[model samples]
Target: MGTIKRDKGLDNTLKVMKQGYLYITNQRKRLGSENIFETRALGGKKIIVISGKDAAELFYDNDKIERSGTLPKRVVNTLFGKGAIHTTTGKKHIDRKALFMSLMTEGNLKHLRELTRNHWYMNTQKMEQMDQINIYRESIVQLTKIGTKWAGVQAPEEKIEEIATDMDVMIDSFKGLGGKFKGYKASVDARKRVEDWLEDQIIQTRKGKIFPPEGTALYEFAHWEDYKGNPMDSRLCAIDLMNTFRPLIAINRFVSFGLLAMHEHPITREKIKSDDDYAYMFSQEVRRFYPFVPFLPAKAKTDIQFEGHPIEKDTMIALDIYGTMHREDVFENPDDFYPERFKDWDGSPFDLIPQGGGDYYTNHRCAGEWMTIIIMEETMKYFAERVTYDVPEQDLTVDLNSIPGYVKSGFIIENLREVV
Candidate 1:
């Protein structure tokens, strides 16, 4: 057994906020640790940071670590609502996951992809009329509409932007309480507004005031029975309904990232348009190369040994998401933006964990992961093949120091028009 490197500090909480996505990786580099290190933060709360394939395997090992009550209240209240599946454990997790997986049918996914393409085609008309468009802003509106429509939740045209902004804020809230930049106040209010909106829909569903089509997300979750054969709490049902499609909205950032990629790597952009398979690879690379989540936390279920270090029961363990995907041992020249690498990529869940690393059915992996891929692929191909636009001079830099970063100016584009 080996002694794990401990951070020399009373607390490094503020450093994490300032460092953002690179915090853990920065720690490992400074500590000269292989894959695991300990950091004291949140007023000396012991946090074990683990990365790479082995750490992911252990993190998702339900017997070793569990997720219930692991996320901070601020995270739950904003990013994932109370009683979300991200906080489930044991048998309940299985049942709750089944509820989500049921909605991921192949036919349903196809419908979503079609919706993505349709929305993009429509948005181009609006973009063409305008002198310029912020890809990120327009993407939020289009994705929110697609997600709500696919989930059978109808948002009035005027309400789409509001709903989208709220959802986007919820995702951005993952940074937790970090001064004014984290937007803590906005995070709480965003969840409240969205929850109330969806709860009302759940109510209307029950009273038959609204008809969410069968096989759609809102309909299934609204009528869902808990593992104990009881109707789930209305708020939980609404949370799950949002869970179903809100992630589709989450892909809005990826739309911007994918466009940014096209602009930066012009050769790959031309390659992606002609090659469908390469486009999928490009989408996967976008998810891998860009930052989405920084880390995910779980608590040790019992005393366990990992990487020659002891972890006491109930210790908080953070799976280093950004660090894992960018590990050189996993990807050659890890810093480079290369899509071709995925062509020969081994299909290990732990290796490419931008969303998460585990069995989709039985673990806490993003249920809408497939939707992210589908939407990203469609968005990548659309802008690559269907639309012609100019990448105006703007801050295209994606700050590694930002949690869930986007191109600084949202990847500005001007003179948008249909492809010849």
Candidate 2:
């Protein structure tokens, strides 16, 4: 075994900042190393960036790496929330994760899909009255409504826009420096208000002041018990509830990419309209081809070695999610957008993780992934068959340097019309 190659620099923090999603893969190509390399980032913190299927498998091993203390403090405060499930491990993680997994049943998924389709129809009707709309912006508002309602949280009709904007700002905070401070502020403020509201609901549910449908996420999470058979911390319960809500709204990014794919590959639109299976394929391709989550961070739980590289206990490691999905060996012509490639996909957990890899129930994989797919498939079918809108000439380039990238023009559309 050989020592892992290291990039020479005082620190690669600026390199990572400048390169964003391309940082790791670019270094791999320049150094000609076998999918593992070391660099310093974020104020000179030693980070081992790893890619490829086997590396991902190793990275997710619970005994080797742990999620706690891996994410940036700012990230936890802004995006994930303090005490969120993303920060737990062992039996605590399993018990908390079960609350989320329980809400992912077939009946619940069908209910979410119905809510999504209904919201889309209402939003499209409103859009038809206007001259143009940004699908990315519209999706945030629409999906927020669907997410809040389906999760059994009640938002007044008037406050949905405010709540939606806060969620959007929280996600946007993880990206560029220009908006980072403002995004952080928004996240802090939003968490306080949202958590306060959710705590009230949890209290109401516990006291019978309000009854969320028994099987709904709101009620389940409100009443969920921890490993000690005590009710979860009210604030933590609220944070976990937002975990279910926020990611659904964040699917707007993928929805925007899905629209871009259809516009670029017009032929696929007809196939998407005619074949349900094809729509699912198109959704998978969009996830693979786009840049959403760039990387996932974890910490070495104990001194360990991978491919002869010694990782000290508590050393930070980054799994290159973008690089793995685009690895040439794993994905043929990986840069090209091709939906048909998924027709015979082998379903390897590590190969195609736009979300985190490994078993959802036991690992740190995004619990809301199935709900994301259901929403995307429904959105594709809606755009293909039930709605018609013109994609006006606009900048459609996706900036690789942007974390959670978006179409440059947010996928503008005009002259919206309902097919019915």
Please give the range of 10 consecutive residues that has the lowest summed lDDT in model 2: 175-184
- The C-alpha RMSD in Å for every predicted model, in order, reads 1.4, 1.5
TM-score of candidate 1 to 2 decimals? 0.97
Model 1 CA lDDT for position 115: 97
lDDT of 2 by residue, 153-242 (tens): 988889999989888888776763322364567678887888888888888888899988888888999888777889987788888888
Q: Write the per-residue lDDT of candidate 1 for residues 1-420, one digit (tens) a residue.
A: 889998778888888878988998888998899799998876678989898999999998988887888788777878888888988888888998998899889999999999999999988888899988998888889999999999999799999989999998888887664434448789788888888899999999988999989999888888988878998889888887888877788787888988888888899878986786988899999999998888988889999989779999999989999889898987889899999999989889898999898998888988888889999888888888898889877888889987768788988899998987
Q: Looking at candidate 2, what is the lDDT of residue 134?
A: 90
Clashing pairs in 2: none
TM-scores for all predictions: 0.97, 0.97
| lDDT (Cα, 0-100) at 335 in candidate 1 | 96
Backbone clash count for every predicted candidate, in the order shown:
0, 0
lDDT measured at residue 155 in model 2 versus the true structure, 0 to 100: 87
